[model samples]
Target: MSHKNKKISSTPKHTIIKALEKAGGRPKAVTEAADTGSDSEDNSSPENLLTPKDVIAIVTKTIQSELRSIVSELRSEISELGSRTDVVENQLDVVSKHQQTTDTEIADLRAEFSTFKDQLEDLENRNRRNNIWIKNVPESISAEALPDYLEGLFLQMLPDLSKESLNLDRAHRALRPKPNPDQPPRDIIIRFHFFKTKERIMASARNAQSISYSGSHLQLYQDLAQSTLKKRRDLINVTKVLRNHSIKYKWGFPFQLIVSKDGRSHSVRTPEQGLDLLRRLHLIQDSDPSTSASPSQQKTSAPTPSWQKM
Candidate 1:
């Protein structure tokens, strides 16, 4: 085929004709004559062709339409994700608030329990104020005979005590099963009608060198709450150290052990504190064990002097 007759393909002819006119090298009459010949030829032929400018415009329009659809889909997805994030944040806030309220309620309950415990302890101590514990008295004495026996015992032990001054109220053993056949009976607990009478009895007991009934050695002690009794027991070693050193000391009410040395009194609450004080006074060696005194030793020991009433 001749070079002029060899036609382009895959492009519209008018597009090429317009491009030729815009290029201005081809005369306008020649471009118009080419367009007329192209229109007269078979329009369905593969040789029909378009210009580069037309191709660029068509591609740009198709790309723009696809981008618009993609953008619309992305916006919808983003809106749904934002709504889900807001719901999750709201749920987290509710959970945090509930945890705070639960913590506050637990704190309140703990405070209330502490207050109730203190009040209950106070009541227990108050109930024991006018009572005394007597040990080594024979279990043979019946409860009905206890008051009279105690009165007579007091009168004999305490020279200043009178029958009318005794003011006895009630007496009984500890609230527990009787001891085994081989073991001794429980201590007798006595309650006096008056605190003054009880105080007098305790003072007399303290001043006495020894107390006995039916050849059995008897001991007297204040009827204290179990907690207070345990605390006092813990102080037995401290008491022994003071006594061995001739250091004056006494047990104050509600579990305070007071030691007087060089005219200065030191109050001790725990066994550790007592041991510390004794170490400072050079009364007991550091290696000494702070074991409580045995029952027999405690009974035989002299009462602590300079007792103070609280």
Candidate 2:
């Protein structure tokens, strides 16, 4: 066990272990096995000494063996991972196609629903065609007398029209909730028996400028379905622009506004189209705040003489 007799290897095994440790990727088993080899050298006879080349070759052989084992295990795992990736890619492709199909179906359903809604709204408007909305009518009369009261009021506007011609099919306040006594009287909705009579009444009311009942200023409006009202409200700015330019425009059937300019008729169907028409006419500036605003966002314009929310 003399230190002089301990020189079995020229290259110290401890230096090799340190180099492996500094490299930092070798497994702990590599260091442990090197330490065991170093310990065994202490017991070996000097006659059985290893040269520096022999020591280096042993370390290199062990490192290469460990590396080959690691490479083999990694290749197996990488092959399994590649198989899993292929499965996942196939599933994603299937899911992407399914999503596209769902999107197309949803779009079709939405279009169908929109068409149905427009038809329903048109039906509602047609049902209300013969109705006249009378606002600020005094609440003093009984429900049974409401029709008679409305008939008398219309007769004053149309003196030539007989009382029987202005006969109302139905008359009632557009009542909601408990009546607020202090608020201006609830509006009266009167349904004329004949469409021609309703038209005559409306024209006469318009000519009179304003109807007065016992000095209470009465307002008249043609009853419109909520959807039709909304459509008109959306195009309120377009009409405002038209009036500004002395352009003649009238509301067309269903949901269109026909403009007469330069002896040609331009029809607008939607608010978007209304906006485009305004843009083409240079009626509205691109930077105008109303251009970017939605129909509801812009201040709601009322019918001339401000008959709304009836």
Candidate 3:
């Protein structure tokens, strides 16, 4: 017999005998009877030692053990799968909350951006109504010079008017004045950025009745009016007429301009006082009659107009 076959033949017989003995039985009797039915020519065959039933019983027990082990391993794998499922659910909840928070923050930023855009548009519209004027002045008149003159002169006209004056070497200017006899006066033009100051300039025009500015020095007031909306409109009617006239005035340093025949001398209000002479002749008109009258009557009984302050 081959070695491998012999070992296989002995394996079933040995397993059956061991199981039968443990049960208090003889595996040899069953094996010997089983071999007689198998029609074995050799009576010394190894199959005579055991029966098939005994072998089958041993294999059934072994199979049951293996099944139990497989069942236990399957239970352990199921438990691990349940734990993994819980972890996945927790991670999903966290991701969902984070996405909601991110969405809310994005919405807030969009609202803020909209508000900022509206404010920017409003500022741009307001700037359109404001204007600036400048004149190419002589080198002698330093940048600091005109600002001082404007501060002193305007302060006298409107003591309550709060304003800041500046004379930048390169101030922004616009050409909106009508063409006058001088074409474009190249002295200097001051500017006001805020539109509200325009009302103050208009008020100055109406209150300059007591002043007289020489024709040669008229550019100073004209430049001021052009810098603001309210004053520009008030001056438009006059500018149109003066632009058509062709007349030049003499110019010199100290300018030797007569501010008022009333003999009131002060740099604080010289320009306004001079404008009063040209525009509001009513101030000088009433004065001449009273002075021309008898000196005794003027002092004793002359009544003052409501326009003049005591």
Give the number of the best model, judged by TM-score.
Answer: 2
| TM-score preference between candidates 2 and 3, better one | 2
Number of the top lDDT candidate: 2
RMSD of each: 17.3, 12.4, 28.5
Candidate 1 segments exceeding 4 Å error: 1-122, 284-310
Name the lDDT of candidate 2.
0.73
How good is model 2 by TM-score? 0.72
User: What is candidate 3's TM-score against the reference?
Assistant: 0.31
lDDT string for model 2 (124-200, tens) is 87888899888887778779887667667776777798866777788888777536778778888888888999989
Candidate 2 ranges with C-alpha deviation above 4 Å: 1-47, 162-165, 177-181, 206-208, 295-310
Alpha-carbon runs more than 4 Å astray in model 3: 1-50, 124-310
Report lDDT per candidate. Answer: 0.71, 0.73, 0.45
Taking the tens digit of each residue's C-alpha lDDT, what string does model 3 give over 71-142?
Answer: 776677778877887787788767767766776787789789966754564454344333333233333444
Cα-based lDDT at residue 209, candidate 2: 61
Per-candidate TM-scores read: 0.54, 0.72, 0.31
Candidate 1 yields a Cα-based lDDT of 0.71
